[model samples]
Target chain A: MSTTDTKRIVIEPVTRVEGHGKVTILLDEQKQVTEARFHIVEFRGFERFVQGRPFWEVPVIIQRLCGICPVSHHLCAAKAMDIIVGADKLTPTAEKMRRLMHYGQTLQSHALHFFHLVSPDLLLGFDADPKIRNVIGVIEKFPDLAVQGVMMRKYGQEVIKATSGKKIHGTGAIPGGINKNLSIEERDALLADIDQQMEWARGALKVARDYTVENLDKIASFGSFDSNHLSIVRQDGCLDLYDGNLRAIDAEGNSIFDQVAPKDYLNVIAEEVRNWSYMKFPFIKEIGPENGWYRVGPLARINTCDFIDTPEAEAARKEFMAVTDGKPNNITMAYHWARMIETLHSAEKIQELLNDPDLQGEDLLVTGERRDEAVAIVEAPRGTLFHHYKVNDQDQIVMANLIVSTTSNNEPMNRAVRKVAQDHIAGAAEITEGLLNRVEVAIRAYDPCLSCATHALGQMPLIVELYDADGGLIDKKVKG
Target chain B: MSETITFTIDGVKVQGAGGQTILQAAQDAGVYIPRLCAKEELSPFGSCRVCTVLVDGRPQTACTYPIAEDMIVESDSEQVAAIRRDIIDMLFVEGNHYCMFCETSGDCELQALAYRFGITAPKFPYMFPKREIDMSHPEIFIDRDRCILCARCVRASRDLDEKAVFQFVGRGPDKRIAVNAESRLVDTNIDVTDEAISICPVGALIRKKGSYAVPYGQRKYDHEPIGSDIEKARKAE
Candidate 1:
């Protein structure tokens, strides 16, 4: 085996992201850890493909990037399209509808990451039997909790479907505003589920809190690294997932940058291309990649925000912030904990939006003349996603640049993987699969969207429709 | 020549124009004929074969087969419906139709037809055949993987827009749509305002710079199924 001569370990296609990962762990001549690398191999070339297309279709087209959080891409592209359409401020109905839909979007994505992707490691132990180390396994272990998770995700999807027409890719988000109002029937249906989901969310918070407290030592040491954190917050420093001011907190939890607009992204954030991977390395221009690389998504949001606006999430945030001891929390495993707090916030936000009468208000859209250039940002379930466009006077898109959340987290994910590898793989007593599991746990902690990372020639998942005798849909089967 | 004709479809007496096809007669008589390429404005080009029906004991494309006297058409039978389902399934396998992430998903004719016939999964293995995507056209881009070789774009460009910019190249599995003007789409004198852009039944030929103008919930096909308007019109008649 090549394990002896070079002592380099190659774990191909890390499971549960399900595919498209190659972790290369290099060992020194003495078999001590030299360096570990996370290699992303998917490439869709979205930037190149969208070149000559009309900027108006980018929201719908680019939203096809990920099925899990298509709404994020849809909304972000819609915001950019809004700027292109010359909408300085959105209509009341449009703003509320987008906010409601985005909450559902974040809720469903976080539910998926926690229950389906990250739970097996938390509940069944990281080195648990590979057969039952999945969402299916969660069902076998804690049946009721798994059901709750499914219901929570269903709750999110149902809200999305009712408002957006479809959960995966609906035309709910248009430039300047949305295309439809949240009908009374749809709003009522979502409102009815709010109380039940709130209970489930509180349950999730308890579960996450218990686990984090119980395993603080192991969780802190396992994929832990001290670095900066970046997320968008409101002007008052409250958490704002949809629209906010950019905030960056250093290792000591001190503010390095604050309240920057999406247009000025070029000044602060820049990409460093590496030959080894298709994903770009994003960093703060002031510090450079060596120290500029910061974490995003749940942990970043939780660390940087002054307080969560919601009552329930605020309580959770207060408890979560205690772990930082006035500094940015870098315990990578705490991402799961931070995720549930945001989920609780989403559930509360969903209920709040449903109660508003303007959710069903009229004049959902507004149109205008074309703007030459625009950039839009939204905090996706993972992290901040950027969609920038340069359109011609004729309204044709000349060029497009996308900085998806997974790409932003590429450096940190690799660093976490490297940390786990250096610790577990060094002086290995024959390098068992259990040690390898530790490295995988690090990557999973970030809940990285590999499909969006490498953008591997964007695969179109195949689905066949089945209809009843009355020409009504009976079933649909999807295959990739 | 007779001014009108009568046809029996699924034991219902249907009335239509004398020279019209069975699909047209069925549609005129308030029956929905599942089709991908056959549009009202365009001349019937039976390329997709999705509108296949049992003409007596044999299968025929309803879009091309003219309605004759006492035509015993089995358009709604489980057997004929299965044939239509098979055709849709073939189309699904033959192209890179990823409806899950397609821009034209809900409003796409292929998808709407699939929904009408109740196709859950294609019987054939997905041939993820590599295809080219031309983003050269400033106003529009075509994803060849989603093209079903319906030739609607070709005909629409030539007949409607009167600019024969798109043409088909190759044959069999290798057959695909291509640009007639060399040096890519930008070199062609195609305009974004051309009516041909709306003629595409799939996500293949999409207008650039004008995406997601309509949100998902308020899209053309949301709430109502694809052919519901025709069915509703027939009911009103």
Candidate 2:
């Protein structure tokens, strides 16, 4: 056959995802993959949106940033506001209530991403018929696990509703403290299903671990790379999702930075904007942008932390580490297992919190000398989230800056897409459905929230368009 | 004038003082005429017109319209209810009333009235008019987007608080609440404890901080409709 001209493959609005993204693949004259770019089309101007508004309202208003993880934004903003009010030390009731809410968010978000979004590809074959390779397909083939996922998600949401005022965009946390405490009735209701929730959480973890161990070889090289990891850890180096100091480690698990204060985030992390993407690439300031880009979310958090506080999750974490001979697991797909471990830990923490007397205390708020500026960081279900705000003397917000988890993972996601393209699509004679699915599998492992990354509002329908080198449309595929 | 007057609201007998308006008399008789601007603590401004009732086959604002002997007021009749709904709808469209993230959502009288009337959305298109936010005060702020021009704050400030800190400026579509100061609330003498700060039926005039502090199912009007207290009072009697 005569040499075919170079072509570009476009995948617009990747399916089974939370936000809008388009993947472009550049092929050379020999049909070898030359470049792959993941473009974020979602628009985000939330920082400007909150300007001139009262600092007290930031927690509520910022929830509009992303529907999937509004709780994370809510808690993080409240944490920043806590510092502004000079309530650096929250009351026991206030701290416990906020922790319960955060853990609830982690559990629900992780469950939704794993069961509803990524499970179909794992439980069913990646090359399975597109029509049946979805949450619906999971429900059809494995009804028990599907129901467990939905119920577990519902349980987490109920916890949020009980702590916050409502399930969606809750008004639970306020400046200096929280709005309400867990009443006996609410606590009892949650306690009723605690055992079952723990059971299901363990089951989900088992599913992820078994699949990873069985397919270790195939996935060890699937979209995998060695880079730096970042997250927050307890003072003693336990995995602390709700609050802690920042810790970063290289691929070999050496500490790059430890115990950095949230207020000094600008001294370390910096964001660089690229022309091709709406989202900015964040990197370690000292290392420079080129090689400083690091990974966040579940895998990074697990790698950066010293130990899991919960018993069963600690066991699981040890097993996960042993697989890599006590090294940071660099495989992209390991995010699933790390995420499940967090889920189990969240369940354990929720049980501990519900039984604590602090959650029932009446002292819910505290105040002290005021501050004009503050910064807060939390481990959102996806990764590390940063919130910084400067308030005027009148208590109005003068400035706001948010580094969302998905935005921090921008370069890593692009690299993941490129790796998948190289392994599956480079020099292929024909682009089969299985090959396209392989690319999606890599992207899904990170569980990216393009909506949060771009901070824009819209729906996404999957559309894949194939174009020739001359810019002629060769084929189109769509799924909603 | 007689000392007392006998009237019927929705065909139910109600007796009240001769000087009382229809809304006051109805309240005395455990009837609620779903109001926005009429507060017992302040003189009725009658700007919202949400309490419109058909008195003797003619429309009248129940807040300002005095009751007469043997007057038949159709407060809950379909005609009157429809008129009230339309007025509430217009109030919603005239300004940007985003109830979703509004701090005063569950506790807002306007939102409660909307819930009682089942107004999921306004029948009219939103004006989406540009509005100013006054956050200059250390203890208080105002979001004009959620303002309904109810003037509760105006009446409470002038008549109750006696500060005369608030007043209505402009006319018709341009009408808005104006503070005594040249531009911002900080320049005025109004404190966070002033009646005007707490009199707002919507999220317009809010004290700084402590928004959405009330949980769901326990907000002022969450479990019951806005006027259910009055109805309950009647039933108790």
Candidate 3:
């Protein structure tokens, strides 16, 4: 075999991520990584399946998009339905409660990502022994941090369960407003945990900062690239997750467009397909289709936002800035920083929402007359998710088009994986599992939920085909 | 115009529209017939057998039995009640239904119908099969032990929601609702909104993350059926 053929590497079924994915890299005869391919092997047609259901059923139906972050789908779908149905008619209390429930979801999800999923890769070495490098490992090695993470996550789950009726796909959040009401006792219980959660979140941030700062070499070793970042920014320009206009900023930290409406996301962002994978790449409109690569999720959120709203979160953001010079564009390290910053923000935001008096006895749901069409947008843990629906006269859903955040960044993730794989290969003899794992983890930094993004099909086995330097099929493996 | 078919139900001389099923005529006349698996939102699946009524000296599920001209329908007879009780008993015995500790106990349709028929105990020995509880989903829980295999959730998923998140796995009495391809609910594509949880008539299917708020007797259904609430929503719409 030629030197280039020896350099070609393939990694299948990237672990600890939400869904199934693979990475392949091609190198030249000199062993220089030439091309990287990140392949999504599954399809989940959420938007297509939602067509012809009742508009009111959209939230309930779309909530099934992801088991881990059902609230994101629930809120996004509800907000989209609100837009079609007219959001102004909903009571202020209902809106606030919805925001609270959504924040609760964000808290748990971010915690899960940081502590349970990616923390092991960061705290322990990415190449740490697989058996001792998971959430369970965290529990045995760093018992205090693990307990804090689990408890903090539990607190968030409790809040979501209390408001939504179920922890996963709570029926409490509906089209017009929420379906369940919150009581003073529940509010008080959440408040009781707020201080503890904030404390634990602070500790988690400290741990992240210490680890990142100590391992700056390792953190920076992960390939960093120039890509535009996108997220939902509040009207006042503060970071907002539940409801806000979408914002796209270039790699130079310049805003591409401000206040792009949810329904018009397709206009601002376009999806590109590659036959190699099911995931479609999305890019900014102004960047000229092929050149406009944008990133979302934790790194994107941090880059796009000016400052964190809460005090502790702002401190964590400062520490995050210390590592990446204010805007970290490295896709691999973004997972670590994003988890840290989001954990802080989630805790801080939950405290703020819980302190609101209206949350006690406020009207949870607003009964409104159905409209012909509606749209909702929310910042899921991954990125900005959009839900649009058209209802017939009988209020049944006529059509639905959901553009999940993970789907929007699918192309960029693939590109990032390829870039990292090529850089890490650097004329090496072959792709090492460490290099391929980092590439996959780079995608996981965005916390890509393939189930939510693909939106089509069920647990079909993943077929991964390996190619030699000349694109010849070398080997194949099937993963369920 | 087609010729009209007249029918007598429960001693009421009811004028039926042509081609209307006996159950449809009875429903049109505001007469109520107990049905377990009949959801307005889904196609009629006569799996529950609770809607059985005597038609022309034979017991048949009203949902599947179409209206016949001069059909003598006995919706509530001693024999019909006995058969309904037997079916309910079989369902109760086939699954592990410990209603006392169940979240949906008081408001459960199966339990309510059983109580109405004065069925205090199962005639057959309880098939105490071990079942798994899937808490993989952060939001919902699935108690396979409490499932009676009604297939309502499965049908609603495939026919109405079109997500097909739920499917029947295994065969015979060993059959159960499987979320996605795995036994674990979290790993599956089944979202919390799929309504499979709400559609479950027993405690077998449950919302995982939120169970404590109502404090036992104060559930949303304590005062009314979900059907009535849906009716109000429909009327408003």
Candidate 4:
């Protein structure tokens, strides 16, 4: 087979994911897979965008980077500014309020990703007729599940509105502390539906768990590879999405580095910029770029942590780990199961926070000796997010370096794309809609937010193009 | 005391002193002409043409044009509304007015006027010109990007505060409010409690510590329109 006459397949703006991304797969003369690349097409330079802005405005202004995960950016930027303002220790009320907001963000984001983006592929079958493999198809086929997903997402959004003051681009989390406390009326309203939300979350978790268990043989090696897992975990080794120390584990569940302070993240991790992609490749410093690339988000978070804090999610985590005999579940599709476990955990955490009396406390802000530089990280819905800022004497942001979650998972996503391309599309006589969808299914497993990586807007159309080795287009497929 | 002058605004009779402008007479009659640069406590400055109304079949600023006995004024006509809406649109595209994150959003006069006129977005393309912020002052900061060049602060500082802390330093399009000092506001003698600091109709001048202190629905213009307080008096009369 002559590698010179390779056939190329390009999927521009992968659909159902946030932001714009394109996938290019190269095939040899025999149509065997040669290379696959996931390219983040748009770049808005959000890090440079924040420079010269006042440090206090970073939290609110940073939300423009991603519409889907605004709360994550809002809270992450606020945490960094909290240090700049010398609020080393937030009051209990402030801490809990921020946690509640973070959990709400996680629940809603994961719910939207699973029920809307992933279910179409799983329920309709990847090779199902392209016409019915859409939102209308999912609704027409699974009405009850569709309603549950919508209502669950709505409940999480309500929690966000109550804590952050609005559903979108909320200014709830501020430097030092929050601007307002949860009023009694707001608390009562959320409390009314907390139990129902918890029940729905459990039902969602079961859907993911049963699906993963039933199709274990089929999805076990579907775009799956052994890789390092990274996330933040409590000092006691419990899963903590809002606040924790950095941790990383190898494929065999051995701790590579445990309890690394977020402020000292630079020592252990570094990002590599490549000429081909707008997103950066983050990897462990010692292992270097080639092999150090690790997976993040739900699968990694579940793998790296000893146990989840919440009861039901912890039990679910145990069963999830048992699938791989207590080793890191490297099956790419297992991300869905891991994500649902977190969704259930977030719901339970929201319930617990709603019952606490400290939410009504008046002591919100706490300030002390201010620092000129600060670094903060929080587990966003996708993965670990890093926000670093340096302010001058006038409090204007002189420097900003943000490594969004999507950027951290860049290499892993590309690997997943390559694996899928090799398995399904490499030797095919002709590229079918179902085979192309298999590639999308692999990338969607990570739920990569290309918008956050490139700091672009939401909603992108899918365009698949096939070109000959001479760089001429041979076939095309388009979808929204 | 000046002699009383009578006028008809939008087919309604109104009275004012001889030296009073159409805006003054309209206010006395409980009609809001929607002037941004014209504050009750400060001298009227006709920089913002948002109050343009036809006086005797000619367009004139209600804030600057003096009222005369039996003079006819049309403020509610579609032509006048279009002019006001155009000025609002121009003000928006000419500056980097990000109301979503701005502190004085709900309470801002510019925002309220836009809301009242049903202008969700400007018609013209955004300039997005580079702008600078001055946070040298310990208590107050100036985000010049949001400035509409209304000059309310200039008049307030000169007339009410008696400090002359702010003034227009540049020409049209390049125009901006500058402090009394050579470059920075830190050198000026403006206090946090100065009437000029609180008189800004937009987020151009903001207090440092309290951005979004008030929650939604409780801010100054949240419950009603910006001029509803002045308009409510008309219904009572």
- Candidate 2: the clashing residue pairs are none
**Sorted by lDDT, highest first, which candidate order results?**
2, 4, 1, 3
Give the clash count for model 4: 0
* Runs of candidate 4 exceeding 4 Å displacement: A1-4
Query: For candidate 4, what's the RMSD?
Result: 1.8
The model with the greater DockQ, 1 or 2, is 2
lDDT of 4: 0.89
TM-score on alpha carbons, each prediction: 0.80, 0.97, 0.69, 0.97
The order by descending DockQ is 2, 4, 1, 3
Q: Report every candidate's CA lDDT.
A: 0.82, 0.89, 0.72, 0.89
Q: What is each candidate's DockQ, to 2 decimals?
A: 0.29, 0.75, 0.04, 0.59
Model 3 is docked with a DockQ of: 0.04
Higher lDDT: candidate 3 or 4? 4
lDDT by residue for model 3 (B1-237), tens: 867677777676666677665656667666556778876667777888888998878888887777767678898678887888889999898887866435566578888777767889999898888776665565666778778777888987787678777888898877877877655777777777777678988777776433322432266565565335434543564
What TM-score would chain A of each candidate receive against the reference chain A? 0.93, 0.98, 0.91, 0.98
Which segments of candidate 2 are over 4 A away from where they belong? A1-4
Q: CA lDDT of A397 in candidate 3?
A: 63
- Residue A5 of model 4, lDDT score: 62
The reply for model 3, stretches above 4 Å from the true place, is: A1-8, A322-331, A365-370, A456-466, A469-480, B1-237
Candidate 1 similarity to native, TM-score: 0.80
- Give candidate 2's iRMS in Å, 1 decimal: 1.3
